[model samples]
Target chain A: MSDDGPRGQVGKDSFEARLKSAREKQGLDPKASDPDKRLSAPSAMGVGMRVGVELVSAMVVAVAIGWALDRWLHTSPAFLVVFVLLGFGAGLANLWRVMGPGRMPGAK
Target chain B: MPQLDFGNPLLLAQVVWLGIIFLVLYLLLSRWALPQVGAVLAHRAETIAADLDVARRAKEEADAAVAELTRATREAHAGAQAEIAAAVAAAKAKTDAESADLNAKLDAQIAAAEERIAVARTSALGALEQVAVETAREVVGRLIGSSLDPALVPQAVAGVLAARAK
Candidate 1:
């Protein structure tokens, strides 16, 4: 009788596996195999909004600083051009931070 | 456009007021609303954890009960098998004993019957010899008008019967 224990355990394990798959198919247990993937993935709309905010915020701040510096130094449009390029580069960097392989920002 | 007019003095004041409103809203959300939501979330988490604990314990109990049931069933099966073996052995022993006793009784009866048959055969042979002697004596008396010697008749009958037996 004790010899049946392992066989029963094997049967139970298969039953549990099948049950888990059925639950997953029914949307009851959602992708329980990988918690990290679920946690690190954001909705597409959220991604789009964050990207827009990151790019526009950096650009707006840069443009404001450039405009103020031009007023202070009397060098019109030179700092604006430089800061515009820098802002674009910063935006790209922020995008990389959000969508990079590290997945830190997305996880947060 | 009135909005784009740099000469407007109220634009700066508008920006200052906007900043003040933003700060007030941020403060209110951070101090009151967010914390309340966090507390409720924590409570729900605690409840879920407690429920999960209870469910886990129930599952463990069910597993234990199943194991116990299996063990009992196995034990019972084994016991039944043992009992069946014992019963079969007992029946076989009883049948063997009965057959052996019947065989012994039959053998004794057969031996006794054989002895009775032997006795009957010997008595019949003795009666045949006596009848032969009397029959010869009567034939001799009728032929000769005198009874033959009975002793002589017995001797002659005995001789003939002995030769036939041989």
Candidate 2:
């Protein structure tokens, strides 16, 4: 068959070819992907623990200083009692400092 | 160890001295250490609050910047989509117009081809009719042993040509 002529056969062939090309162009192809995660809790807890340790250290230092002062004064039990109580007060103050803003009960 | 005399006036006086020392220490702490420590703590708290405020403001500003960028990005995306849609629509419209033009051209070509075919067929039929008439005349002349009219032949040919033209 002489199907290469410009009338019946050639027109039908061109229309079919254009239709197939359009369908191929409009085809959809999708792909899958992943998402990300975050970490915050452990780090915040570590920071809080560090602050507590600092307050305790300050209290220990205050107590040691009071003991040394009592020994220097040579007042035996008298200075020891007074200095220890002062150290306790200083420790509570240091704890309050670490706590920040809000006052702790029995601290005064 | 020997028992210390807790009932002795000297021991009681020493105990009273210790109590006095504790009172003095308490007074000193209440007057000096507490205020100084409280002041330091208040200052630190203020500093922390200021830092937190600064951080919060910075975060808010960053958030605002991100929001603005997102809005701009969305707007840009929408604009690009609109542009793409417009381009596609224009292409479709142009394609439709071109197809219509091609269809009209094809129709014209088909009509011209049909007219040419019709003309060719009419010409071929006219030639066939002339041949038939010439053959008939020759056969008739041979059978009758006489020559046909030359003017009648021309007139018959003219009539056949006119009929074919219609």
TM-score of each: 0.62, 0.45
Q: List candidate 2 segments past 4 Å from native.
A: A1-108, B1-32, B154-166
Model 2 clash pairs?
none
Q: Which number leads on lDDT?
A: 1
Candidate 1 — which pairs collide?
A: none
User: What lDDT does the true structure give each of the candidates?
Assistant: 0.83, 0.69
Considering every candidate listed, which one attains the maximal DockQ?
1
Off by over 4 Å in 1: A1-108, B1-20, B147-150
Weakest 10 consecutive residues of candidate 2 chain A by summed lDDT: A27-36
Q: Residue B58 in model 2: shift from native, Å? A: 3.2
Tens-place lDDT digits, model 2, residues B1-166: 1238766788888879999999999999999999999999888767766655565566568668867986898899999999999999999999999999999999999999999999998888778777867876787788977988856765786787778779
Q: For residues B61-131, what per-residue lDDT tens digits would candidate 1 score against the true structure?
A: 87899979988998999999999999999999999999999999999999999999999988999999988
Backbone clash count for every predicted candidate, in the order shown:
0, 0
Q: How many residue pairs clash in model 2?
A: 0
Q: What is each candidate's DockQ, to 2 decimals?
A: 0.14, 0.01
Predicted candidate 2 versus true structure: per-residue lDDT over A77-98, tens digit per residue: 6755665676667656765674
